[model samples]
Target chain A: MTTPLISAAERQRIRSGAHSGPTAGLAPGHVQANLAILPADWAGDFLRFCQANPKACPVLAVSEVGDQALPTLGRGIDIRTDVPRYRVYRDGVLTEEPTDIAALWRDDFVSFLIGCSFSFEEALLADGVPVRHIALDRNVPMYETGIACVPAGRFSGNMVVSMRPMTPRDAIRAIQITSRFPSVHGAPVHFGDPAAIGIRDIAAPEHGEAVPIEPGEVPVFWACGVTPQVAIRNARPPIAIAHSPGAMLITDLLNTQLSVL
Target chain B: MTTPLISAAERQRIRSGAHSGPTAGLAPGHVQANLAILPADWAGDFLRFCQANPKACPVLAVSEVGDQALPTLGRGIDIRTDVPRYRVYRDGVLTEEPTDIAALWRDDFVSFLIGCSFSFEEALLADGVPVRHIALDRNVPMYETGIACVPAGRFSGNMVVSMRPMTPRDAIRAIQITSRFPSVHGAPVHFGDPAAIGIRDIAAPEHGEAVPIEPGEVPVFWACGVTPQVAIRNARPPIAIAHSPGAMLITDLLNTQLSVL
Candidate 1:
């Protein structure tokens, strides 16, 4: 009753309609995932898309067709009710933001849990690398780059990246730290001049608030979880669903378990 | 004999005074090392200096006082004769360049073999990261930075770093690749604007030939093995010796063996 401290407990509270906010600081050491649900027909291509663009969309778990339970990520994880918030999209347009997808659940629905930057951000913070957005109490700046993701059947789009401003020294250490967590956006896709990656204005971003870049600090970028969402939107399927921004599924898997090294 | 194909064979040839030139391409997959031999009286401080500034002076192995063999690095490696060429420093001044130090060998001479950048450069090339200096057939540009090395005893000086221009994408990849070889200078110390590290000119370097930094490429800098040499020169021991520039000690250890991961 005093705000669940464990991932399973937090998920249970969310499932019972108690906690319906962002899961940012919940279950501190556990891995939180971005959610995506699609019809079985679109699942194959989405899976291929995740495989092809792993840095942006590292697939953590895929539920069997129509199954609400993701047994691989955590015990008793009901995809329909476990996430704090969800966005129901029809024909690539957001039609509803629901706390539970039980009413919209279809037998053809397939759920995927993809790696999120939160895991690597935890790592960066643990290593004393300042995450400017988090410190400034704002969202990490998100930019759409000219860099295109490898196409998979019906899924393709330019890679979307989240930027963190840091000095060259911290950026180098962040690269090394994140390289160990390949499942969660891995190392940075690019750093320095954003123009090279096709971002015209460093002060402006397509999504999220732009954090201030102090003098002598360069904006380091990592492929973002929004990238897969972008691909899903571009594919324009009849129906799709994803967790509402910042409202991720708290998984039982410890973040340390994701360090490939 | 036909240009001895292995590291041991090459060492034997160098011992016999047959091969006295730079050892850049010879024994491709094996680890080559920069050499520094100091009298036992000055060796303790030098060892401490290497320990304190590992990234700049990664000590591969240190020899017993008065002993000529470095059994740890390679079998039958006679320190006095294994290196292709040697430079004797008298009171921090260059006094002689000799193929073999048999005449100058002293019972109190303690040899230190330091990890060279060649190992990481090989790793970089293998990963398809273009090393501009190598591609342009010039020495990697080295600069004296305002970044100070942690002082040990009488050894203290600003760090010396070697620069290689690479695209951000390639630089990111290079950082990952080189991070695996911690013994060989590990990852880069700095990148981007040279002025941030107190270098006034990018076109002219204090040591080594300056390679052109192409459009979209950032100059990546790594802690160089020359740092210890600079410190040693400042310490001004009565007598010291080192391998002639680029004429390293060819070791039997494979470069891949140095990978910490």
Candidate 2:
């Protein structure tokens, strides 16, 4: 096999505060994760929320209360400093965006690492299936769908889906490819008519910039990683922290290892 | 495993000239094939056509010239009389629909047994995926699409696809399931807009009865076994024979054995 363009060296650079930005397109072939840190008092509800809405928030690993290390995901990985950036939320409001959360780490803080879409997108591109937004160098279009996620305790909200435009033939292959990696939002939640899932305007997305849908192409939607952020906002815990958009926690795990087939 | 609804006894009954009609629901777990027999002179072009249009004419077995048996498909299976009904065409024109072809059998005749959609439909129904036409007790609707099959020698024509109405979620699961059985048409070629593939009237199919598409359901189209028949007519072979519509050759091979994964 060919050598990956990036390696674990990038994670070391990020750990040493040399890199502080979105981790997208960095450390190719590695599993990058969406991070969520919460107080132990609220961890139970958050874990239950992930279990209920698995497609949206497939939990990869959970740290012990007050522990900053995630040994299972990577070698000597420190959750407080390994990620490029973090967003601090206080009572559901954005409070701070920090590079290192060591100063603010609480004794009862628990870290949750959830799977991201990069893994399956890698698989799609490897199979020669075009990912429209990625080709155009734009964030994947995200929309709030009418389909409701199963609620757990205080976490109750509709699902958020990320969209990619593809021809019907490519979409079928994409479904088969993505189904093997259930940890990163398995098979698509919907395809074709956006209105069927309650998204009225194709040009206007709720979160990311809208990408062009070429002739003979239909927008395919997958459950988004942003769903947990929406659930967290609904829950309104006393304190919570998550990775900044696209600034993920790079892990030692290889993305291809996640394929069940 | 529990006993199949129809046993190998049905094939015995058909061989003994006791049964002569459509074999649709006769053998539950076994494979049923669409048969195409042609003169040795035309066999090469037909085989190439099947190889070119695999999704439409997936070849399950091919008999040697002058052979009347298909040993690989079943024990003591004689292709000449095993099928309940046969349609004989002379110079591209339908001449006779006969119960047995013993009188018309030629030493230079070659038989091609192609996969049928019944195998994958059984898999889909077994996995709890609703097949609309089956629920309504109607033939699966088939349409001629603008998508042309790759021309092989004298055989060149547009593809014929069968339609099944399913919700996007169910369609995703069905794609995953059907992909396992590539010999039986594999995954859907297209879904949603029928006009994208050049079918103008969704209600009026060229063959089979049209089943209703319920609200929130889209028509998923798979390459149809009828495609080879159309190709044969276009080729205008001096002599050709095929099984009558829905009157298939039952094989002892289990449908489950066709799954690649």
Candidate 3:
């Protein structure tokens, strides 16, 4: 197995335009965050939404308006160039997928570094809890749940959850392990029957590739980082930018630093 | 509703033979322990069994041989009298149910105060997670599982688990809440499927009354204090003592003090 790059080195590679790919497994112990850059006009509402629905949108760090650097998350980090790729959305529609957002940078832009599942997934793996999606080499299954996010100002949308199949034994351990990292969605929101949460079909996921659930395993669901993206889509801001799916903002903060306990 | 007494006052009543019924809901915030007194020769192995199976038998306090007071648990607490009632067993068969064991106490006896679910259950209720059995005024259903405890010396037996049915939402919260109190069985051992853990029937439990598991609810199982009791029976010690069902030993220690966090 190849050794993973350090968070700063990986961010440096991405900043230099030498690496343009998914950030998964890039930095072994560092936190990789979901990116959401919105206009200053919409940032406050988005912040309120995150505050109201913390499990789904745990805000790790927020950049000052017109600032490109997230000093708290990492040293010398540039929001414009550090992410491997960025998706520019215009009026809630995807306008372009760009390697860098320098050309489209606006003075009113505010960056949000939301806690991603990568942190808690790392915690789960460290505790010997089997994260099925990682083992199967597949994208974690995600579905649009009937549970609605507590609306804040203009943002309103249903929650989107990521699922991992685990036996009840493993699920219990996973819950204890993940509860320590409240910033990374904390413990699971639901498990067992899918219909109970208004997900009609377990095999057919609305967002990511479906993974097989063994006979004795229950599909444990955690609030996904994608929930914020869905809310952004519904809010329909004039201009918004986010890291391309899987191309997260690698931060200097270690996953262990997020543990509330 | 009847006002509950303080821990010390409740224990005083029990010791005075004025309170011989169940100890549940008597001293609300205090930690109530399951009692196990055995001959000094058999105590070492029983302690090992508890250490090996902490999730099922978390030892809160163990007494010195011939000592009746658990000073660490409560002030002026006598194990022989603090408990509401005690069960005397000879050669694995229960022989008597006494209000106090002071008359039966031997100089070679060693008292063990094992954590009971009451501590975590109080936490769960405080956190607004409904404990089904408690709400229904019935005993929490318990079953014998095929999962065997690690044997230490003469003690060996399959684990016994107590079941509490909950919706997936409540189960997730309950797991997080209970995990904080590791001495009180910690988090649940298994959930979702009963057969997965060798439980033949959900409705028919080996011990305690069965409560309804409404639609959308799954049965969550926690490693029970009774696990050591089963081991005690299998060990067939010449003389053994345990707290009568629901008649726990009231401790001065607050339930919140048990939280590892």
lDDT of 3 by residue, B93-210 (tens): 8899999887898999999999999999998998999999899888788899999999999999999999999988899899888988899999899998899899999999887789
Each model's lDDT: 0.89, 0.89, 0.89
Give me the candidate number with maximum DockQ.
Answer: 1
Residue-by-residue lDDT tens digits, candidate 1, B125-241 = 988888887887776788988999999888899898999999999999999999999999999999999999989999999877888888999999999877877887888889999
Model 1: CA > 4 A from native: A1-5, A16-18, B1-5
Using DockQ as the measure, what is the rank order of every candidate, best first? 1, 3, 2
Question: What's the TM-score of chain A alone for every prediction?
Answer: 0.95, 0.94, 0.95
Query: Which window of 10 residues has the lowest lDDT sum in candidate 2 chain A?
Result: A1-10
By summed lDDT, the worst window of 10 consecutive residues in model 3 chain B runs over B1-10
TM-score of each: 0.95, 0.95, 0.94
Candidate 3's C-alpha runs over 4 A off are A1-5, B1-5
Q: Give me the displacement of residue B248 in model 1, in angstroms.
A: 1.1
